[model samples]
Target chain A: MTVEVDVTIKPKRGVADPEGENTKKALHLLGFRNVRSVKSMKTFRIELELDAETTGDAEEEAVTSAVEEMCEKLLSNPVIHDYEILIVGRQIGN
Target chain B: MTVEVDVTIKPKRGVADPEGENTKKALHLLGFRNVRSVKSMKTFRIELELDAETTGDAEEEAVTSAVEEMCEKLLSNPVIHDYEILIVGRQIGN
Candidate 1:
């Protein structure tokens, strides 16, 4: 089976985003008023291959584990950031 | 007129992404091999209110200017990052 995943990570609200803040200032200078907040996000496309017999539970477990592990390990900064994951493509029972 | 913009910003390839690099190292520790690259991106949802008579050209120019300004001002660091924009919804001739 093959799968594609899209992931986004952003600093939690109210936490200072230097990049976002600087951008806000620039927008104000450019005359865009009423601009509220600026947040950042990241997306990923991951492709994985697995065997037939191990398709169902194994695939799910593997992905779940990988995502969680990735989040904790590299995708997010637990203290200041949050992440969202979307599974784009999935195939089963083939 | 109303419009929705989804923007993504990331460091150019071969540029060092500290956050991405840390995550990559973590993934390696967790045993996911062959991982190629990790990049960070940000999305913005902007809603603007404009009048009827000024809808056509004004809206286009305003948005184009706003987007460019925003990218230079806040969305991306011109020296190291790149950005892409997608307009999600648009209503004209109302």
Candidate 2:
């Protein structure tokens, strides 16, 4: 089974978000005075090939475990970023 | 009325996504052989202050117009990227 995982990683509140700040400033310049603020986050869609038979609780566990491992090891830097893991759906490989 | 907008920007198909590539390579090194691929995108949460009385169609028009202007002017570069604009909700200034 190929599971699609969406990892939304964002800078924690109070952390510097230069990209967001720049975007807000640019919007203001463009006459979007109503644009009060902006925040930017990165979303990574990971296509993981899990065991076809891992079903029910086991399947969910396998997916989360793999997704968490990826997040901890590479997708997210624990110090300044926080991430949310979402199982989008199963994908059929072409 | 303060409306929240989410601008999802992604590199167009056939365009290079170095960040996604790097993440995939990192995952492979970590033994996620089943991780077939990865795609990444940036989501911008723009908080805009609209007219409290601009309700219904007029309100929607104001929001989209401002959001679209921002996207064309800064949030997304049309040549290499494609973006989806979504109206999240309204927020109260606190």
| Candidate 1 backbone clash number | 5
* Residue range B1-94, candidate 1, lDDT tens digits: 5565667777777787777666556666777774444444557655444555665567777766777777887667899888777665675533
**Pairs clashing in candidate 1?**
A23-B74, A41-B41, A41-B42, A42-B41, A74-B23
Docking quality category of candidate 1 according to DockQ thresholds: acceptable
**Please, what is the whole-model Cα lDDT of each candidate in the order they appear?**
0.64, 0.85
- C-alpha-based local distance difference test score of model 2: 0.85
Candidate 2 docking DockQ? 0.79
Worst 10 residues of 2 chain B by lDDT: B85-94
lDDT of 2 at A29: 82
TM-score leader: 2
Error of 2 at B82 (Å): 0.9
Model 1, retained fraction of real contacts? 0.28
TM-score of chain B of 1: 0.67
- Against the native complex, each candidate's DockQ, computed on alpha carbons, is 0.26, 0.79
Q: Name the Cα RMSD for model 1.
A: 5.6
Which DockQ value does candidate 1 get? 0.26
